[model samples]
Target: MDDLTGGGAPDSTGAPLLDVFMQGTTFFDMVLTGLPSQPVPGTEIHAEGMGSCPGGIANLAIAASRLGLRTGLASTFGDDVYGDFLWRTLEQEGVDLTRSQRVADWHSPVTVSLAVHRDRAMVTHAHSSPVPLAGLVSDTPITRIGFVSLDEEPEPWVSRAKAKGAKLFGDVGWDPSGRWAPEELTGLGDLHAFLPNSTEAMAYTRTEDPRAALMSLAELVPVVVVTCGGQGSIGIDSLTSEEEWVPSLPVNAVDATGAGDVFDAAFILGTLREWPLRNRMAFGNLCAALSVQQVGGSLAAPGWGDLADWLAGVRHAAAAGSRSAAVLANSYGFVADELPSHPAVSLRRAVATIARMSDA
Candidate 1:
């Protein structure tokens, strides 16, 4: 990859052809846990667990890296203590930071999350804005798949990346404006896949039905997927006029943060392996469910061992000829026959690494 850091061309250091190059915000997240209830004014609440680590797109990059994908990140960071922590954490995770920038006199974005019950509430402050997309992709070698948001106007960089044969994957955030303007999707016409939650897709398309939303978005992009939290996800391919729906896997969720990002990473993995769209959504759902059963967003992401264990259970059920298991087998057939026995990092090691990074 072309070196955006001016250090040199990115060394082979096991870096693949920029499998997933993400451009977005990165946060330094400080987590507080074991709270009995929400805090009141002038009250002191303590937690059993407290630590910090990288957040935002770093979650996605870490999730993809754990899944054994070659990942690169392009975003700006403040030249502060928090930025130093984030940089060290990501580098230890083996993520490529050649495209990242550290700006002077700025404070890195930070989020303080309070964990209650099975969810969390977060407060964030960002002191530095992201580097423009054009500058990020200017002379750098584009990854096979480039991820960006369509929340704003179509940027010239989208077409520039596509011109170099990179497939674009588009996602969006909540429209606080509530206008949910359709023109916001104007950039998707040049994208290869559009992935959004049911609410965002429905609101943007002005349709309450998920299938309708999927089909509507399919008109603008070749591939459209609408993730419906518990109802599962819906996908359609305009090229073949094919549609698929995958039900969500049942799991006791401890934290739903970063589940969507993990799902995106897994779905992109499926796409890279040429798995059928149905399987992609199923895999995404399974991985997302596994993630929610843990704490924190990025920290909760599953590793290869987690996936293998889950697959082992599914295969055991499939061996008993269970109907639901049979259906899952059809979708996850690759796992039984092709998945590796070990993960790049085991859960124990991942946790230990997080602990180390948090303390740093």
Candidate 2:
């Protein structure tokens, strides 16, 4: 964790030092896992296990922070128990929330997630925030990166952050409206990178193939990445004319919530470290793969310690004459060079509840 912080110290400018800055809504997520099957309509079913955590933008925030990036989040929280839990949980995870506020008499957003069949279905109840995101951070702090959602128009603070030299990474959610309008991506020119799953990318680019979509998006953003779930991810760096395709790690996915956010965090970390484009994509894919093995979204994010353990396991298996493990070990050999001499052991992990408990 110490090595992963990326040395978040303010320069002579005296601005809040941060590696990643994010602004968005936060949700109190209740995740029920290990269900035998999806519930039929109007039927009651029992889950084998459950977990709770802060979700939404907090997913990316915790993901970045756990990876040792100085992370800061700006958003509104309701003056309620759920909101209080979210605030404390994020703070405990070492996320800086100085730009966040607690609104009076507002209801916190809540999401109930059902994780079954290696995927999840969510029912969310949320209202428009009392305050807009632009009102949360009037002066964007100097940071190495900023994360944004391309579901709507870019916020004013996003442009301000870009002007302040923050490289922006943008992602999009499923368009419930199904318009997938090309105009929705008009803000691509202002972003340093844009990551969209193959479906979203093809729909927006109006291309039949993922690579074609990636090429079409490359014409707009400097970096374009299209994630193809089981098949892997394809990316193009226009500045360097580098095109890379990294396959996904084979893992038993328990819940895929927030996996994309974790991937984005890992990719952002690699980009900040100036790693090779291929390594960046592979690292992101690995992180996302690890994240889906757990139930909770933010709580399930893996730290550097987790990466170290996974690498060690892969090498051990490779030494035991497992062909697949040997191949995987070779593919991720670069991770060894990036790990610290001694990774932190007391790193965070998914829990069944968000209640505050003594470290003891």
Candidate 3:
């Protein structure tokens, strides 16, 4: 009965069914080095090389591919080094990029991350908007898509997706204060979930109590999840359903970049698998948990088995004691003691050689 698909996947009783499609957005990431200490005033810190990866769609596509989905990435990038890498990465990950485009004269957006104390701060510049607003919808294989996710965009496609029988989720990474209000976003779109962490929620709601803040969004959508570091997350699913708290897994954070995006991918994966709502939050939490254990954004995400092992008490526990930093510190100390003398120096040498080869 739908324009997208004949009856658009109706059941024997002529009701709708959920058949999802996974797609990725494109972003560029630059990884830099810095010690996790307060920078001395006016002092230039020693530096490291830039490591680039495909983010947003590319990043999520990698995860989806690993999960055995027929994933696709729909975005535009330039015919530069980053674009080449993006294409290769998607193909290697088994995602369909036939519909993905490379435009002339446009530069893929770039984000630079400064790593400090196992965390990072980023500065981003979109050389140009890679995908225009008009290019959001596609006719190819639209009927199979059970859900559509948009990050930071809440317009025309939101209503279109709803019409196509796709569940929708929107992520607000960050925004300039008052760039848009919470109600404005909530009103602008019909969403199943609105994913914004505590910091963003506080800014959007101007409320410190995360529960109250998450509840505020539920007035519009059926669910709202607000992620916090140690405090975990607050979620609400129904009008009469109680708000729930989802805890983060313990990790030895190498860099905090892309944790939220990984959470987005995991949430999608969980939802597709028909996971219980609490487990969906748990899966998202676990995905971020795996991401922070290593360096950079897309580079750090764990395969599903790795995440499952960690949660099953089969791995990572020895490294993430009491889910505490002390555990990570202790684990690092033990590993260091077993290594050859000057382990960090040797590790750096090995890495530098590889970087030079890759850049060559």
**CA-only RMSD, every prediction:** 4.7, 2.2, 9.2
Model 1 ranges with Cα > 4 A deviation: 1-16, 31-51, 114-120, 130-134, 153-156, 316-331, 341-344, 347-360
Residues 107-206 of candidate 3: C-alpha lDDT, one tens digit per residue: 7777777777766677778765556734743443342332344334444544665686667666665565645465546442466777887877777777
User: What is each predicted model's overall lDDT from 0 to 1?
Assistant: 0.76, 0.87, 0.58
lDDT of 2 by residue, 111-132 (tens): 9999988778899999998887
Root mean square deviation (Cα) for candidate 2: 2.2
- The best candidate in terms of TM-score: 2
As for candidate 2, its clashing pairs are none
lDDT top scorer: 2
Prediction 2 global C-alpha lDDT? 0.87
Worst 10 residues of 3 by lDDT: 343-352
The TM-score-based order of candidates, best leading, equals 2, 1, 3
- How many steric clashes between backbone atoms does each model show? 0, 0, 5
- TM values, all candidates: 0.84, 0.94, 0.74
